[model samples]
Target: MCWDDGMVDPAPTDTGRAPADEPAARPAVRIAVAQRVPPRYGDPPALRRLATAATDANGADLLLVPELYPAGFRLDTDELAELAESRESFAAHLGAVARTHRIAIVAGYPERGPDDTVYSSAIFVDADGTELAHYRKLHLFGDETAAFGRGHQVPPVCRWRGWGVGLALCYDIEFPELARLLADRGADLICVPAGNMVGYSEVPEVLVPARACENQVFVAYANYCNSDDEFDYDGHSVVASPYGSLLAEAGQDEPQVLMVDLDPGLQAAARAHNTHRNDRRHDVYRGPDPTIG
Candidate 1:
C-alpha cells in the first residue's frame, strides 16, 4: 500500500446520533463486494470463472468488482491501449456471466472512448443478460488524470428489483456532494468501485459509512487488494448501512467477497431519523448555477 504524508486518514465526525430501530418488514437484496481481482493481463476465462464462483457460492443478487477490473489501475496509454476493452465486448462477456449465474453484476474496465480517449468506466449487468446502468468515473484520481479522460455527466440511478442504485468511482464518493446528489434523486443505495491503497484505507472504514448515513442510503465499496509491481492496495472491502454501521468488512491484506443485505424499508426508517436530506438550506449553498449543475 502506498502512503503519503500529504493525505490524512479520514475520520467520521458525526458519530453520536441516537439509534433508531430499523423496520423489520423491509425487503432486502443480497449483495457482494470483491476485494481483489486479476490484473490487466489476466486471462478472460479466468476472470469470468472467478465472478461466477463469487455469485454462485454466496447466492448474491448483485456482485460488484473493483474499479478497472480487467485492465489494471496504473497502466499508461501504450499498455492500456493494447489492453483497452471495447464497451461492446466487455458488456457481452459480463452479460453472459450474469445470465449464466443468474446474478446481477457490476464490473469496471478501461473503456476506449472517442478521440482516442480511454475512460475508467463501469456497467451494471442485470440477471437476464441486460444492461441496467452505466457510468464513467466522474472524478479522476492521482495518476488517473493522465491515464484517462474525465466523464462529463452523472449516471442515472438504476432501478433494481425495487432499489434505486447509484454508481460512483473511488474518489467521487469521497466528495460528499456526489452521494448527496444521488440521495436527493431518491437513491436507496450507492455502489463504489475503488482501487484504494494503504494509508488511504480509511475510506471504507470511515468515509463509506459517513456517506451512507448522511445520504440515508446503503453503500457497498469494493476495492482491489494486495500489491502489484506499481502499487499495493489496502484490500479492506466494506458494506455500510444507512445507520453508519459497518455491516461487513474484509481484512487489510486479504481478498474477499462479502455478502450483505440492503433493506429499503430500513433505509427509509433511517431517513426518518435523518431529516437533513430535505431540511438542508440549499438556497444559501447553491453555489454554481445548475446550468453547470
Candidate 2:
C-alpha cells in the first residue's frame, strides 16, 4: 500500500452526536453512490460543488463517487502522478463538502507514494474532513499491475454510525475470498468503486449481489458513466440487500446517484437465517495449495 503505516490519525471530532438520553434514535440512513465519470480536466471547486449538490438532493447520510474521480484511469505512472493531488488537499475539499452537507464521503483517486510509485487508493472522509480509513487496491487490473505495486494488508473494518464498512476497488470484487475476509473481520457493508466497460457490466449486476448473498452483507457497486467514444461504460450501479435482493439500480449509459437505505438488523437476521460461510468445513476445503492456477 502507498499509505503511511505510521500515520494513525483519529477520526474528526466535529461529527454531530445525538443526546445521551435521546433513546439512541433509529434514524433511517440513506446512502447515495454516484455512477458518473468525473470530468478529466475541471476545477476541483466545481467538482466539490457538484458532489455537495448531489448529497443535498438525495439527503444522503453517506456519498460514494467512482474510482479515479480526479483523473480518468491513466495507465502511465507519471501521468497518474501528475493527476494526483496531495491527500491533505483532496481531503480538505471533500471534507468541506461533507461538513457542509453533513454527510460522510468515500472517493477514489490515484495516489503518488514517497518512493514515487503510484497506487490506486480510496479515502473515507468524515463530515469534518477527518480521514477514517485509506484502502489501496490489493488486486491490480490489466496494465495497472505493470504500473503499481500490489497492496499487501487488508484494511480494517471502518466504524461509522454503528455500522461497520469495508472498502474495495474494481477487480477486487471478483475475488470472493476478500469479501469473506472482510465479513470475518466484522464488516456489515462493502463499498466498491469500479470502472466497468461495456462488456463487464454483468460482473457487477450478477456477481455483486451473489457476493452479498453469500457473505450476508449489503454491497454497493458504483461504476463510472463513460468517457469519449473510445471508452464507454455500462453504468449499472447497484445496491443489493443482504439477502441478495436488488434494492436499487441505475440504468445503463447514464449518470445517476443511486440511493438506498441499509438496515443492519435485517442483515443480521439474514445471516442467522442462512449461515453459509459461518458454518463451513475449512479443514476439507483447504486443498493442496498451488501458486499458479
Candidate 3:
C-alpha cells in the first residue's frame, strides 16, 4: 500500500509459494521508501517527525530513508561536527518511533565515531525498539572522499523474517560488482539511500533495473526530493523486481512514500526464466575494458 499526499490503496498480497510442504512459508514484505530531504542542521526533531510520519502513513514493515537524513549532507568539517550525533542516541530516537508504530525503520545519518571521524551510516531498528544492524557506507561521494573516511568493511546481511537484506549507499549502487557481490553472498534485496541530482535520473530508471535483472535480486532506491531550494532532486524512488520490472515509482518532485510487496519466489523464477546464470561464461568471456578494470 502507498500513501502519497493522502492517496492510499490496498497493496497486493503474496500468495505464491515454492511448494506445499516447504519448511518456511514465503512471507510478503511491504517496504516504503521515503523520498525527502532531511531538515537542515540542528533540526533532529523535525527529522524524526518526517521519518515517523512516513512510517505511520505507509504502515510498512520496513521504511528506508535517504543518507544524511538527520543533517543535510554537510561537507564542511565545522558543520559536520556541529550536527553529528552518537549512533546510540540516534538509534534510540528511531527505536522509539519503531516501537510506537510496530514497524521497522532504516534511517540514515552522519555518525561521529570515537575516533572523531564522521561516517555516513544507516541504522536498522526493529518494532520492539532493538537496534538490528548498522551499515556504514563503504563508497563515499566525490567530495565525501576528502571529508569523511571510507568504511573498510561491508555490513552484515540484514535478516528480517528469514529474508537476507543488503545495504548500499548512493554511489555504491553505481558499481555493478557491488550488487553482484551482495547477490553472491545470498542477499535477496538491496536497499539504497541516495541523494541524486536532476541529471542522474537514468540511475534509478535504467541502471537500477539493469542491476536487478542482472543480479536476480530486488532493489529499493530512495532518493532525496528537494534540498536547500537551490537543488531539485529527481525523486524517482523505485522498487524493482529481479526481472528488472519496476514495481513502484514515486514522482519527480514530491515527499512521497511508495510501498511495494516483495516476493522472493518471483525473483527466483525470473532468474531461472531469463537464463541469466546458465548463459554466463565466467571462465572464457572477458567483459569490456571498463568492466574488467
Candidate 4:
C-alpha cells in the first residue's frame, strides 16, 4: 500500500533479471558518480558539459550527477523560474546524451511544471534513451523552500539493467522515511543527486552509509565539489554498500568521478543476516491515541 496518497506506485517491469546463461558471480551493475560543478544559470555550456561527462563514464552502466546541475545552485525564486525548463526538454536532452553514451543517467534539473511553477527535479533516462522516472525533490532545505514548490509525489523504483533503481535529492537522503519507503518498494539502489555544502561533511561520511546498511540497499550520492555563487560545496561524493561500507568517495574540493560495481549478492547476504525490515514492530509505531492523552 502507498503510504502517501499523492504517491503513484510505478509498475516495475522486470527488465533487470539475469539471463540463465549469465554468470552468478558477475556484478549486477556499475555506476559512476560525477562530482563536478556545472556552468552557471542560463549558461549554455552546462548542457554540453553533461554530455561530456557521460562520455567520460564510457563503460559504466549508469551515471549519477548532482542536483540542479543544469542551472547553478543557490538561485532565488525569480532565477529558479527563469532557469527552469519543461521536463520534456530536459528529458530529450538527457535521452540524447544517454543514447549517445549508452549509459543510463540520473541527473537533476530545474523543472518548469504546469502553471509555471518550478521544482528541484531529477530524471532517469535508460541507456537506450527511454525516460524511466522523474522525481522532484521532496524535502526542501534552507533557501530551497522559497525557491521551488514542494514535490507531492513519492519517488518511484524502476527496474533497470538488472537492478531496482530509485531516485532522491540531497536533503531528501537525510530523511530515513523516504529511503525506507524506497526499500520497501523494492529498490536495490538509491541514487541521490545533491548540492550539500562544506559544513555538512557527515552526510556523505556518516548518514549515507547508515541509510544503506539500514535498508540493505546500495546508496550513491553525487555532489558538487566547487563553490557556486552562494555556497561552497563539501564535495565528498560517495557510494555505500548494503553492508554500510564506503565503496568509493571523492575529495572535498576537487572535481572527481567515482566508479563502483554493485553486487546484488551483497544485498542478499545483508538481508540474510540483518533482517531489520522484517523486525519492525509496525503496530507500536503509531501516534499516541488522542482519546488517552
- Among these predicted structures, which one has the highest lDDT? 4
Query: Local error of candidate 3 at 65, Å?
Result: 0.9
lDDT of 2: 0.72
Model 2, 197-242: lDDT tens digits are 7888777778899889998878888887766433777788899888
Candidate 3 is scored at a TM of 0.83
Q: How well is each residue in 1-293 modelled by candidate 3, as lDDT tens digits? A: 11111222223223211112121355878998887754665555644664566555565888888877777666778888877788898898888878878888777788888888998887877778898777778888678887777876655455567666777888888899878766654567888888777888999999999889987789999888766533567788899999999999998877888888888678758867776645566546665555554
State residue 70's C-alpha deviation in candidate 3, in Å. 0.9
How many backbone collisions does model 2 have? 0
The C-alpha TM-scores of every prediction are: 0.85, 0.84, 0.83, 0.89
Best by TM-score: 4
Ranking by lDDT: 4, 1, 3, 2
Predictions in order: lDDT: 0.76, 0.72, 0.74, 0.83
In candidate 3, stretches whose alpha carbon ends up further than 4 angstroms from where it belongs are 1-24, 42-47, 278-293
Worst lDDT 10-window in candidate 4? 15-24
| Candidate 4, 1-293: lDDT as tens digits | 21232555545334322121122434578899999965665567566888988988888999999998888676688777777899899999999989989999999989999889899999999988899898888999877788898998878777676566788999999999999878777677899999899898999999999999998889999999878667788999999998899999999988888989888777788867777877776557776665784
Error (Å) of candidate 3 at residue 207 is: 1.4
Candidate structures ordered by TM-score, highest first? 4, 1, 2, 3
Residue 46 in model 1: shift from native, Å?
A: 6.0
The candidate, 3 or 4, that scores higher on TM-score is 4
Q: Candidate 2: TM-score?
A: 0.84
